[model samples]
Target: MSQPSQRPEFPVHLLSSPAMIEACRERDFARIFTLARRAGMHNSLIARLCDMTASRVGEVISGTRQLRDMAVIERVSDGLRIPGHMLGLARRDWESASADPTAPTVDIAPAASGLVPTLPGADLDSILAVAAGPKLSPSTVRALHSSIEDYWRRDDEHGGEVLRPAVVGQLRYVVDLIKETGEGEYRRNLYGVAAELARLTGWTYFDARQYSQARTYFTEALHLAKAVDDRPFMANVLACMSLQATYEERPADAVALSTAAQDCARRQGATPRVMSMLSMREAFAHASMSNRSAAHSALAEAHTCFERISDQDPDPAWVSYFDETKLIVDTGIARGRLGEAEAAEPLVEEALRREPRGNHRGRAFHSFWLARIQLQRGNLDQACDTAASSLELASVVESERVSGHLREFHQQLAPFRKEPAAVAFETQLRATLR
Candidate 1:
C-alpha cells in the first residue's frame, strides 16, 4: 500500500485567543482545526486532542461534516478544555450525573443569537486586537465572503440547527474585521457581506423557531444593508421578514412588509428573480388575508416576472436560489392557504418531483402541503399515506418548521381518528416523536 501523504505545518502564533474562544463557543470544529493547523499543530495532534481519527478531523476541516451531536460536543469540550457556555451545554457534571438512575434531565437551550454584546469602542478595539491580531487584506475579505456563501449553500441542504452557530461565528468575526480597517471598495464589500450574513443568521433563527431573535437580526440586517446602499439585499431581507409574519399568521404585517419589498425591488431595478420572489410573498400575504382576487393577481404578476428571468440576468448571490421550482412551490402554497385545493395539488406535486433528494427539508415541506391538499379533497387514505411519508422525511431533519408542518398534519387527521389509516399514521407519528 502507498504511504499516506504528510500534512504541512502551520505557525502556532496565528491561532489567536479570540479565534479559539469563538470557535469553541460555536462548537465549530472546522474553524478550530484550521486555527490549530495555523498554530503549527498537526492533524495527528489535533485528532489526539479531540479524541478522534485523523480522517474525521480532516472531514470537519473540509466542511464535509459537522459536530452537532451533544455527546460528541461534550467529549470534544472536555478534551479541549472548552468552556461550558461556549458549547451551549450543561455543566460537565451533568453528564456524570446521568449515570445515576434518578438523575434529572438537563435542558440546555441552543446557543444564544451569537451576537456579541456591544462594548465601548476602546475596550472592543483592545479585545479584537488580541483575537484578530492584524488588519485583514482585501483577499482575506474576499475569502470570508466566499465562506459566507458556502454557509448559505450548506444551510439550504442541512437546515438551520446544524449551521447556525458557525455562520453566526463568521458574522461576529467579520464585524470585528470591519472595526479594524477598510475603505472605498473594500469597505463597501465588507459591509455588504456583513449585511448578507446578518440576514442569513436571521433566516436560520426563523427556521429554528426563535422568532424574537430572528426579528432582531432581520432588523439589524436591514439597517446594515441600507447603510451600504445595497437595495436589492435590503429588499430580500424585507421579503424574509414578510415570510416570517405570514408564518405567524400576521397577514397585515406580512402584506405591509411584502409590499415594501416590492417597492424597493422596483426602485432598484432588481433582477426578475428578486421581483418574482417579492411578488410571491405578497401573494401569500393576500391569500392569508382571504383576499382571493388580490392573491390571484399577485400570483399572476409573480409568474410574469419569473418568466422574464434568464441565465444572463444580473441576479444577486442572495437571490440565486429563487428559480422556477421555488416559484412553483410558493405559488402552490399560496393557493393552498386560500383553500384552492384543486389548483394547488398538481403544482405542489410537480414541485415535489422537481425537488432534489438531497433537499430533505424542502421535500418534507412540499410533501406536507400535498398531504393537506389530499385531506381537503376528502381523500383520507391518500392524505394519511402522504403525511406519513412527509413525517418520515421530517424525522431525519432538524427543522422546527418541518416539525410544525407535521403537527398541523396531525391536527388535520383528528377528524378521521376512526379510520384505520389515520390511526396507523398517528401511531407512526407518535413513535417518531418519542
Candidate 2:
C-alpha cells in the first residue's frame, strides 16, 4: 500500500489559552471556531486537528452537536492548541511538554471553583464599585430581578448546561450587592434575590452532577436566606438540599432536610403549593428509604396540599413550576422508586402527555420512569420502545440528570439483552451517547 502524507502540525506555541478551555467547557463552540479561524485554521484543519470527521466539525461549529466526550475534548485541546485543564480535563501531555520546566503546574480542578471567575465584560473591582455606590434605584433592582427570572425560564426550556456560567456570574454580582448594601428593605430584598439566585445556580450545578459545588452553593443560599429572615426562602433552600440528598441516595439526610423544610414552611405560613413541594420531597425520601407506609402518607399529604391550591391564589415565582402536572410526575417517580410499577405507569404517561414539547429534559425524565415501570412489569418490548423515545429526547437536552437516567434505563435492559427490541434499543442508545 502506498503511504499517505501526513499533514503539517500547527505551531504548538499557537495553542489556545485557559480561556479557550473555559469556553469549550461552557459549550461555547462559536468562540472556539472563531478563535481557530482567526488563527488561520479552516474546518478541514480543525477536523484534522481534533481527529473528527469534517462534517462532525461543521456540526459542532454550528451548535448542532456538542463536544462532551472526554476523548473528543482532549483531541480538541490538542488540535486547537488549547490546555486540557480549561475543559476540566486532566493536563494533556502536549500542555506539559509545551510548558517551561521552571513554571509551577496548575492543578486542574472542577470548573465550579470556590471563586467565581470574572465574566467577560465584568470585573470584580467594577462590580464592587457599583455595589458600594449609593443605594441602587428600585428600577435597577427590578431589572436585575427580571433578568434572573428570564434566565430561570430559559433554563426550563434549555437545560442548565448552557446557563450555568451566566447564573453563577449573576449570583456573584447579587451577593456583592447584598454585602455592600446597608440595612434596609432594599437590602433585605437584595438578600432574598441573592438567595434565590444562589439556589438556582446550585440547581444547575446539581443537574450537572457537580455535587461538591452544588452543596457549596446550596449552603450559601441557605445562609443568605437566613440572614434576611426569609423563612419561605429558607424552607425552599432546605427542600432543594433535600432533593440533592435524594438524588445522592442519602435517604436519611433527604428525610431530615425535607422534614425541616416542612416545619419551616408551616411556621412561616407558606403557600399550600410550597407545602406540597416539601411533602413531595418527603415522599421521595421515604421511598428511597424503602418505607412504603411513610412514603404513601407523605404522598397523600402532597396530594391534599396540591388540591387546596386555587388558581387565583398567590404563588411565589419560584414555586409556580409545581403545578398539577409536576405533582403527578413526582408522585409517579416516588411510586416508581418504591417498585410500584403498576401504579406508576398511568401517572407517568399522563405527565408525559401533558409535558410541554419545549421541556425536552422533563419529557426525557418522565419517559425514562415510564420505561422503567414497563421493564419492571416484564414488558420488554414496550420498555425498549419507551426507553428509545427517552433516549432520543435525552440526546437533545444538555442535562446530566437526563443522561444519568438514560444510563440507568440502559442498565435495566440488561436482563432482556437477548431480545430483539433490547438489541435495537441498545444500538440506538450507544449511538446517541456517542
Candidate 3:
C-alpha cells in the first residue's frame, strides 16, 4: 500500500494526520486480540463485526491484514469494548485519499434569494395570534409537534412547500399554550416542545437557503432550551449552531461549538448515542479544516463508542434516531474528507439502505455526499444529477447546513456551466433559494 507521504500530487484536503496514523501503528496488536478474547466473541464473530471475511480478522490479528477501513476499526472497538472515537481516528489515519480532479470549478459566486414566498405581514400576525390563543391543551401542543415533524418529513421527500394553513394554525395553538402557561414544569415541557419545533424549523430554513431566518430560530431555540435548563437539548441547539458555523467555513468556530456540546452531553450524563453525535460534529469540523488527523481520530472514537451502546438503557427522546447505521453515515462523510471515496461510497450506500422512509433529510444528505463522490470519480453528469436531486429534496426544509452543501455543490459544478445538465440544475437551484 502507498503511504500518504509517497504521493506528492495528493490533494491536501484528503490528507489524514500523520501523527494520528502513527498512533494507530503503535497500538499493540496482541493487546487487542487479548481484549477480544475476553469479550467472548470468537474469531468468526469478530470478522463479522468488522465487515470482513472470517479469515480477514484472523489475518489482522496475526499481522497479515491491516486495520484500515472504518468498518474494521469499528469491529476491533466492538470486540474489545474500546471507545469508538479512538478507533475512528486510527482508521482515518489509514484510509486512502481521493479528490475530484474532474470537478467543475465554481466561482464561489454571491448567493441568490427568493425560493419560497415570504409569509405576508397580516398572515404572520394571524398565525402568531392563533399560536398565542387561550386554552390550548397539552394534547393539542403535542399534536402540533407531530404535525411539524410530518411536514418536515414531507418536505424532505417531495420538496419544499409552505406548511398548509391548517398546520400553521396548529402551531399557533401550541405557542399560545407556552405563552399563557408562563413558566413551570408544564411550561418547561412546553418550552422543550417549542425548542424542538424551532430547531427543526431552523434546520428547514437553512435547507431553503434562508440563512438569516435560520439563525433567528436557532438563537430563539437556544434561549428556550436554556430557560428550561435542559442540557441534552442544549447540546442539540449547539449542534445546530455548529452546523451553521461549518456552512460559513468557520471551521474553528464549528470545532468550539461541537466541543462545547460534547462537554454538555457529558455533564448531563448523556448516552453513547449523544456522545457519538457530539463526536461526529467535531469530526465534521476537523474535516472542514483539513486537519486529517483530528477528523479521523474523532471518527474512530465515534465508531468505538457506538459499538458499546447498551440495549437496556432507553435513549433520550431527542436523540433516539441515532443508531449504528447513522454512525456509518457520519463515518462515510469523514472518509470522503480524507480522500477515500472508494471506501466511503459503500458505507454511505449501506447507511441509506438501512435508513427508513420519512428520513427525507438523511436521504438528501446521502445524495449530496454521493454527488461529491461522483465528482471525484470524474462522472460529471451523474454528479450533476445527484446534486439536483439533493437540492430538490433539501429546498423545502429549513436547514442552513444542507443549503450550504448545495452551495458548495454548485461551486464544484461551476466549471461545467456549459453542460446542459449543469445549467438546468443551477436554474432549478436558484429558483428554490429563499
lDDT of 1 by residue, 142-236 (tens): 78778877876666567876776566656666666566554577666777887887888788768866565577788878876786788888889
Stretches of candidate 1 exceeding 4 Å from the true structure: 1-135
Candidate with maximal lDDT: 2
RMSD of each: 16.3, 10.9, 22.5
lDDT of 2 by residue, 1-434 (tens): 98998554434443336655456667576668766776677888888778888888788778787665434565676776565445553345555533533222532222232232221111112222344454577986887788878877777677876776566656666655555566788877887787888788778767776565567678878877887678888999999889889888799999999999999988878889999999999999999999999999999999999989887767788898898899999999999999999999999999998989988888887898899999998998999899999898888877777787777787777777888998999899889875
Question: Is candidate 1 or 2 superior in TM-score?
Answer: 2
lDDT of 3 by residue, 205-323 (tens): 45544445456667767766776677888898898788778776689999999999888878878888788888898898899888999998889878777877888765766676678
Look at candidate 2 and tell me the lDDT of residue 43.
Answer: 83
Task: Using lDDT as the measure, name the better of candidate 1 and candidate 2.
Answer: 2
Alpha carbon deviation, residue 285, candidate 1 (Å):
0.7
TM-score of 2: 0.72
Clashes of each: 2, 2, 36
For each candidate in turn, the TM-score is: 0.70, 0.72, 0.61
Please give the CA lDDT of all the candidate structures.
0.75, 0.76, 0.64
**Candidate 1 vs 3: which has more lDDT:** 1
